[model samples]
Target: MAEWIYEDGIGEARAALIEDGVIVAAEIEADDDGIAAGTIAEGRLVKITVPGRRGLVRLDGGEEVQIEPLPRGVTEGGRLVVEIRRAALPEPGRAKLALARQASPEAGIAQGPTLIERLHASGDAVRRLMAHEADALEAAGWSELLEEARTGEVAFPGGGLRLSLTPAMTLIDVDGWLDPAALSIAGAEAAARMIVRHGIGGSIGIDLPTAGSKAARQAAAEAVDTIVPQPFERTAVNGFGFLQIVRRRLRASLPERLQGDPLGSAARALLRRAERTPGSGMRTISSHPGVIGRIADRPDWQAELARRIGAPIALRPDARLAISGGHVDAENP
Candidate 1:
């Protein structure tokens, strides 16, 4: 059975869709400092890098947006209403904003809690995530899922596929299959599921196992479309077994952020592990320096952990700890 777990912490929030006690989809809600995708705002063109082409705009609150095809009559110093297509990611040297679409004069900005809203209204058991949920999350392969999302690789029955995100589109390369036809059939299904699992959107190119006939190719494309959500288009698998899928992208795919800040994800998981430990007083969490650094960047998170557990936390930086694996034990504050 599938269930929803919504963890509302002091400084961070996460929603997980767990099927058969395993998480199949998840979203991390940002704190105040994070720039979330899907924010619509009024922006003033600050500069015209390429006149009448793409230029930069300073939105309300001093945030810059990348606006292209400058709206008619709009010039440098003019206003351009826009919506955020991609988040201003925290990655180093990642300051450019990606635009999604233009907003109407009457349009009002609205931001929703990513997947958390859906899980809250779902029929599945929805509860605040607790320490006990860790076992279920682990049993459902939380760590493995995090690793897979970080690596952009998924393996199914006959073969596996690696997802590559390009400036133009997201590509899925199928490999390591014994039967080409079976690989196409199964790969199509697997690819679709992975796309949804990672909250991927926009253009996706799936290079399936080359089949012997066009009919077989068409069948594979049809199979893929059956599971995809609405407002999507797909091309028939071509001679090269390349099928292009176009999905509506409203915000930055969760996978992108996860891949960019894996250390943060690991630290969050470690906190979850500590929260669920049966008997706990003040706890000592020793983690890899990488994860420790990420955790230290968020004093709010440390305070939240302490508040939630009703005890202080002592963080020890351990150079020998493996990635995503940390030591948690009770200790005096």
Candidate 2:
């Protein structure tokens, strides 16, 4: 059969297939949504079946249809019958970047087997995997991470909805068996939204606080949809009193990959030396991004180290801390 082509910026466009001056099938292309993401073209095939006919008919309704063959000649019985249907579209999923490649042992990029190459090869899989992983982490849950770190367990205020979050700040709490709580739909929704925006990656457990009232549970579930700025996957409440949420993990957490390790190492060394010196009257402390129920439970600098450093030592909840010019204050506590 002969093929036809037509391009329109509107909804998906397709043209009926023509063979020997007779219509047979239609071809389809996805239309542009007119967004910055650009138009998507998904290949589609629709059969345009005509009664008693052995071919198809060409339709201009932006769809494809195939037909069957019939007796020769044109008439009311010869008129082409068309039924347009859409074909399957490609599934949308994660995307990632490429990575650098490793060199072989014998044929190294350097001169012979001993020299070095000015550049490095790339690994598309590694790059792509890293990129997708980072994205997934960011969308997972940020506030949940923070909440868990702070209190060991944070209840799922959304009632049943899951949370999404950015990469850095996560809010979550410790986990334990608990009854679901009774909360208004509005309250549940607010909690859900907050959870998604602040908590991206890491583990998060939401305790509903009580269970028993169907209205409360329903309200919480509705809140999840209300708070979400975007759609989510793997977000569902379990039979237990917990709301199970798995957001995409983005890149490494702020405390994990970004913070300069050298500086932290140096600070710890300074503290250690101070601690051993004795009578230094100095103290130092460092903290990651969590606030605990007790001061002692919070990470602290050894008294000896603080004395050697020539001042009080401390770590803040925000993970950044320092001492200079007499006073040191930061986000950590």
Candidate whose lDDT is highest? 1
Q: Candidate 1 at 151: error in angstroms? A: 1.9
Model 1 error, position 307 (Å)? 1.0
Backbone clash total, candidate 1: 1
Could you report the Cα RMSD, in angstroms, for every candidate shown? 3.0, 25.4
Report model 2's TM-score to 2 decimal places.
0.28
51-111 per-residue lDDT for model 1 (tens digits): 7677887887686767766777887888767877666543323533655346777878765
Model 2: per-residue Cα lDDT at residue 54: 38
- Each model's lDDT: 0.73, 0.32
- Write candidate 2's Cα lDDT for 111-206 as tens digits: 111001100121111111121123222233322333332232335434333332233333332223334344434344444544543323344444
The runs of at least 3 residues in candidate 1 whose Cα sits more than 4 Å from the true structure, single-residue gaps closed, are: 1-3, 9-11, 19-24, 89-101, 109-115, 118-127, 131-136
| Candidate 2 Cα RMSD (Å) | 25.4
The window of 10 residues in a row where model 2 has the poorest summed lDDT is 111-120
